[model samples]
Target: MKIDDWLLEILACPACKSPLRAESEELACTSCGLIYPVRDDIPVLLVDEARKPS
Candidate 1:
């Protein structure tokens, strides 16, 4: 999954408005313990759809 650098730069966690770091196939919030999934290169940033850090 590839998201544009510019877009990723501006993308933040919907939950805590924290910066996100690109992981295998997800984006992890730096502040909150939320892991957002990337489906078909699209970041699923919905808070309800986020997975709590394990």
Candidate 2:
């Protein structure tokens, strides 16, 4: 499922404790520049699995 607008208010970056925005299929943290993947309708909010900024 897609991330709901209300969920954005509570979802924070697991790495930097920063705010996150819903990208195409992931959650992107502007502060840390990390992209957390969304798989099987679940957000994989893990730093180790997150994509590094390019």
Task: Say which candidate scores most in lDDT.
Answer: 1
Poorest 10 consecutive residues by lDDT, candidate 2: 1-10
True-vs-predicted CA distance for residue 23, candidate 2, Å? 0.9
TM-score of each: 0.92, 0.88
Instruction: Judge candidate 2 against the unseen true structure and give its global Cα lDDT, from 0 to 1.
Output: 0.88
Candidate 1: list runs displaced more than 4 Å. none
In order, candidate lDDTs are 0.91, 0.88
Clashing pairs in 2: none
Best by TM-score: 1
Candidate 2 lDDT by residue in tens digits, 1-54: 577788888899999999999888888997988999999868899999999977
The sequence of per-residue lDDT tens digits that candidate 1 reaches over residues 31-54 is: 987999999999999999999999
Worst 10 residues of 1 by lDDT: 14-23
